[model samples]
Target chain A: MISFFKKDFLVHWRDRKEIIISLISPLVIIAVIGIALPGWVENPTKTLQIKVALVNADDEQAAMQEFRDSLAARSLPDDELLDIEQQLEQLSPIRMLKQVFQAEHVKEIVSMEELGNDDALQQLQEERIAAVVTIPDGFTLAALNKMVWNDGEGTALRIIAEKASLQVGVLNDIIDGYVQKLNVQSAFHHLLGADAGAAAIASDDYSGIGGREMVDGVETVTSFQYYALAISIVFALLLSVTMASKAITEKRERTFQRILLTGSQPFHYLMGKMSAAFCLSILQLSIIILISHFALNIFPGRSLLFWLGVSAVLVLLSLCVGALVVLFTALVFRLHDETANGIAFIFSLIAGTIGGSFVPIYILPDWLRSAGEWTPNGLSLAVLLQWIQTETVADLSVPLVKLAVFAIATIGLASWCFPRRGRI
Target chain B: MLEAMELRKVFKGRTAVDDVSLFLDQGESVGLLGPNGAGKSTTISMISSLLTPNSGDVRLNGVSIVSKPQFIRQVLGVVPQEIALYEELSAYENLKFFGSIYRLKGKQLEAKIQELLEMVGLRDRQKELIKTYSGGMKRRINIAAALLHDPQIVIMDEPTVGIDPQSRNHILETVRLLNREKGTTVLYTSHYMEEVEQLCSRVYIMDHGRIIASGTTEELRRILSGEDTLLLKLDKPNKDLANVLRSLAPIRHVEETDNGLKLIIAKHSSLLSQIVQTAESHQVEIINIHVHTPSLEDVFLHLTGRTLRD
Candidate 1:
């Protein structure tokens, strides 16, 4: 084992490192973009997110008193009420929305870092806040009073920004409009003396019945994550292809062949190559981890399940890829001339692309995304990115199965086609 | 002992080697002779278990290598025709690696590497990368690498193909010494007749993919003992002039040369004037003419029609 490592390390140092830098492109890109932008990886969305503190002024009890409330106090809701009774009404959905402030967008997101200590609303200038909703503490009382007395100040929501970025304006406007409509509807119901009207709106019969309910009726359907997934898989594939070619070169250079002739079985030789590839892949994975964690800080806010899930899937995927590369590269050296190796390189590139290395599957045409999503690189990236963001394993099984199928196919390809005596 | 019995190999749609049989007794040295693409390397590959023959079998001692190639490779040392060793690695490292392959390690591996290095006269230069060495030096290390495991039967495929004469001679000498002192069986293959002539007691001559002739060196040479070879030096030896000289029956073969034509004849008197008269008719100038006894060149000419090298 020591000898194997020594030879592997020497080969890496003496030939590979000198011929080309190790994972230099990833390192450089991660560093340059990471340091220069400091947010590309962290903020996959290129635009600055609008960050505003929710200024609530409901005349409801304090948050501490609210936290103490127990739904258990209610008699187990009668089964009939559970189905159609005015129902156990829930807390109001907050006014969660974004507005494009154009020039003020960047300030809106970054300036909140100092907002906690302000003695005044001095920074509450129109340009300083992209959009503001001053929910007066009497908002709930006013609505109740207007409903009960049929006369009072109805709550108002307004925008403060002079300019609006398109999507931000639209999404934020939609969310704000939703909050207003819900308030009005609830106020209207209270006029009839029915306190549970909020439930009626939530269980809307005429909304986007295509899927799950959305906040403010805005659903975030996307293909962006698919593209990012491709990026990760493509890099891993690049590593695998090089490793496979390097295996043959390592053997021909008389590094491991000599060992094999000394009584080590053919299996031992194969194992050694496998071991080297494993170590290299794992090391590359670590570098990526470091670059992502510290350099980009992409995962700081990510849940532990998300991080674990992504790392686990990627590492295993890389391992199988490395193994397949080794077997094929050795086969190339032994039988076909150098041209086969060239062709393999092209295959790797093509696989990466079709697998969604460059094109994220989401934006791809529906048919293409479906095809790409099932591809090894494409699927692996898709699942991993989803895992990282959602921290859930809901759709991971398909990618895992696809990965296993790919590995098995590659192994069979190598075992059947690789020539035994090509090098000797 | 290493024996290759009626070995045949085919690739795709073509036969590479056909029914070739040969042997090297313990400590004995034999050579396979052929031009380029004569399947010499292929035969070596099969013998070393680097290849599987389509028909026939290779035996290390009396055991068939086809069924159990692992053990066969253990006792066989192979120095390929091309420089198979890594150029980036030092000669010493190459030897140690090959030594370890044969399961020689600790002091034994070191001593073995040192001894082989000394034998090849490359001990002082062993620490240098193989690429740093000259062609001859690389060739020497290549041969030494084969010896690291101290295999009972050592095989070389055109071992001295691209080496300086001095190193070539050193390799030849080393093979002789290993055979004499250690009783190592050697299967040497080469295109150069003289190298085979000097190192091998028996020679197998092959053309295309089949061995056409096989016997002791003397026995093979004796086939053309009745003939004599003549050197007819000419200022301008043209093909037309060669054709004219070739018209003489007793003159068997005529190869054009810058200075003259080298001819092989059955008898001296019957063809000398015919050759001179023919040269005059073609306006060809004869530089010098000398007659000598038959050598491997004549044996090849007699057998292949084209000179051994064409």
Candidate 2:
């Protein structure tokens, strides 16, 4: 084993062409995305209300006052209330609100001449406005039945809103939702009953199932911690494929056979290349781990076990991948001429993606994830995540055993595929 | 000493190496001469234990290498046709890796590396990447790599296939010198007739997975002595003249050559009289005639009726 490891160490330390395959890409990816774009909170919540800039074009005061009174009556949470207050002080669109809150949604009012050539809607969204509500000019009588709390006034208030933007459509949703809520409150108070406050008090005792936490009745994972973990794992898989491809290329070039001629056993040759792969993988995962903590600031080493568990899986995954790669490399070397490297590359990539290296299982459709879980790549990723999250080795009992099974099974398969040839 | 007893290897549906056997005594040099796909490499691979013969035994110094390949592996060094040194490492580094495998290490390994580098005439450029070296240099280092362990027998498989003539000569001379001075037993394989004729004490000519002939170079050539050779060149070619010449007494052989025809006759005999009469009758002009002894190529041609590669 010392002899084998020495061989591996010499090859890796001396060979730059093969070294880059195992090192550069993963580090660069970590540096560019994980480090450069640090603090990417993957699962952002809409619970914190955003403030928007509003501009009103109303010529009347009575309708504006009534709209303001209706909007103020909304029993919003403290954050949303503060956001709304800040936005109104900035936009003052309520001074231009056309009706009392009867309609489900209200449009924003703006003089085209006053609005510059800038992206006003984008400005609203970025400034935390839910949406821009623009109301057209009209007499209060024209909307007596359509309006929520319309007491006939001088002229219709034209409200100019700046809230919802296109990407994620979050800000616009908040503004539209608040508009509807205030409209209903206005209707109850102005149209049917004078006991709108009492009605709200009675109906406020409303709670429902956790829709956001459970997406479509499945346990939803909102944290990007899982996504980062998944990407790094795939990167690790790609690293294995690269290492495997080199092994195949070397064999084809007769380097491995030449080593054998030097009194090196088949196992020594196999384990040497694998040890090189395993070491490089450990280095790669270390860099990725450091990226998550120092750069992304996500998934900090929760405890010693979390780190240890990740390291252990990485080692196992590297070995499994190395075994699989060598088997393919050996198979290609024994069978094909000049095309072995290409075959290994295509095979490793196929295996990597099948193992969920590119797209995470959670992001993939349910059918894809279910079918993909059996593949070595997918199982490796799942096993890793389970191992990382669990507190003890006992909790990882099944996954560790399954990983061992995968390693042994792949080695067996590779052994079958790479049957010794060119000799009697 | 290296020995192969009835070595044979069969591939998918073909017998790549058929019942073949040869032996090399300590300090003695031998050659395997054959065409492409003629089982020379297969034989070498078996002897080197890179391959396991289907039914045979290779013994290094009387130890059964078939059951225990490690013995042959340890006692043998191989110079494969392809330049198998790692392109990524310097020539020194490549040799270091190979040397360490044979249990050479530290100061001893470094000293051997330096000594071998000087032996191959590349001591100054040892640190350069193997990839950057020219073909001849790589071949020299390839040979140097084999010498790293100083094994009892060194097997070379067409080691100078594509090197320059100067490098080829230099490598052959180095092999000859090593064998002469150090008594390094060598099993040199090549299709190049002249190389084996110059360097080997005995030659084995293989064809269609079988050794057609194996003996001392001169001894092998002596088989064709029964048929004396004759050469004839004519101004006007006549097909009938050759048959007429063959009927003459004291003449043993007649064959075509590039310039004209050749005739082989028995020792202390002359057939020019009958040949001149026959050629004159056939209206053929005789140009020149001469007799020469056989060569390794001739021995191969006499046995297999073709050159090594053909």
Candidate 3:
């Protein structure tokens, strides 16, 4: 295994053109994109504001009264009825929705105004608003029933938009976040009982909806830092493809067959390719980070702890990238076609695009951003950014575990796909 | 000894090697002779355990290596038809890598690499990448890479193809040394009859996925012992003369050569005089005439109606 690793490393090192290209391409892209689009990176939300019309069709008083009457009809005890009524007043879904939009950070991005349904539609068509948030009639009654009693189908918040745009996407994300929080609140209520569930919702962590925490008093990421990290991750992912392409050459030249004939285990050969990719990825990431920091001050005035955090993320990301290399290598050997390289390249491109390596996850729709977080590169990028802001070590645990799992799963799949004795 | 029994291989429903059987005794230098698509590489692959036959078994000594490929792999060194060494790596690096995989390490591996470099006459250029070397130089390094482990059996598939005469000679001498001095069993495959004749004690001739004939050089030559080849060099080509010669009762086959006509006839036939007279009657001048004993080339032509190269 060590011999295979050394050979693969030497082979990659000796290819001067490929090595130079791999090291320089990311820096060039970072420079171009970072310089050309400063606004998108430096202040992503500075010039962007989502205008929304909040049309409240439900009467809070009438819904509370209707809820009380329904409880009376069910013949609940007086103490239980009072307890249910108090919980309803405290956890009104409409009030929660309004509070989310009213948050300071949420207010900075979304400007909401109360308007009638006809007026809201007219303004929306006239491009006066990005979307219209409608609170339907009986929403509070239905939501209270579902949350407190686990009865009846829950009412959904209706969002009407003129078209799908960045502003509309952000607005939809904000609403989606609120709904998810509500569902969690409801689950806690059922699992932990009413008082514990209410206490959980009243906790400081859940106080602000769509609000940003100023960790360690650090400012938000600049365009240069964002692109430097994003492009670095994208190129790091590309290293897997590069390694697999080299494997193709070995296969074509019959060098791989020669190695096999030496009685070397196939697993060792795959691990060798993977180790080379892992080393290359770390090298590429380190070089890019150091150069960008020294030359461009991408991570200006960062502490030792910050650098250590970056290193940890780099190692985990490299492991995932290495595992990806073996998967691509296995596919290259199994398919035995020219398109194997193309397939790997396409996969990297798609992963980079969706994983927020090409674009910031904040700008993506809620669903897409969630998916991007699941991707190795995307997860790493998010964690690294968080590390930059918070300088906190505790946050790395979940993402690191996820990255390790990704590595293990990919390596397992690669082993399954790799050709065995007779197949080779 | 290494033996392949009734080996057969098919790719995408097309038979590649069909019921081929051959064996190599310990310390013997045997040749597998065939044309480009005669299944030589496939047969070599199966024997080396790099490829499994559809329905056949290869054995090392008395064990069936088909079910236990490692048995053969341990003792086998395969020099593939293609240059399998890493082009980006130097000759020394390639040798070191291959040697290390076989569990050779430390000073022993370094010395083995040095010895191989000297044997292939590339010691001075060991630091240069294989991509910078000439075709012959690359082929020499390729051969050196296979010998690093000092396996008991070496299977070479057209090792001398597309190489300079000097490198070809060097490779052949290396094989001879391994077989004669080192007592390594060899299975060398090539379409060049002379190389086989010079290096191998026995040869197996294959065509269309099957061995057409196999025997010692002298024994294969005896297939046409009753026949002799007649060469008539004329000033120019004359199809009419060839036809006229073919019609003769003594001549069995007549073929037109570039500068003359060749005839196969009974041994010790007195047809030279009659052939010269016939050329004279046709008003074509006979440049030269010679009677030659049959060779392996003639034997292949006699059996397959085509030259060995074809």
Instruction: Output the number of the TM-score-best candidate.
Output: 3
Order the candidates by TM-score, highest first: 3, 1, 2
Task: Mark the regions of model 1 whose C-alpha exceeds 4 Å error after superposition.
Answer: A1-9, A17-22, A29-233, A247-263, A288-314, A330-343, A365-380, A387-424, B281-283
The DockQ score of candidate 3 comes to 0.57
Q: Of the pair 1 and 3, which is ahead by DockQ?
A: 3
**Which candidate number has the best DockQ?**
3
lDDT of each: 0.64, 0.65, 0.87
Model 1 chain A poorest ten-residue lDDT run: A94-103
* Model 1 agreement with the true structure over A192-275: per-residue lDDT tens digits: 444445444444332221112234533232333332244445666666566566656555545344444455655455555556
Model 3: how far is A236 from its true place, Å? 1.3
TM values, all candidates: 0.68, 0.64, 0.76
**Which run of 10 residues does model 2 chain A get worst, by summed lDDT?**
A104-113
> Per-residue lDDT of A1-424 in model 3, one digit per residue for the tens?
9888998888888888878878888888888887788867555665567899999999988888888788878988888777777776577788778878877788888999999999999999999898999999989888878777788878888999989887787788888888777777788889988776666555434334454444457668888888888889988898888888888878887888998888888899999988888998999999997898888888877789889888999999999999999999999888865777888888898889888887777777798888888889999998988887787889999899999999999999999988877676
A314: Cα error in model 1, Å: 5.0
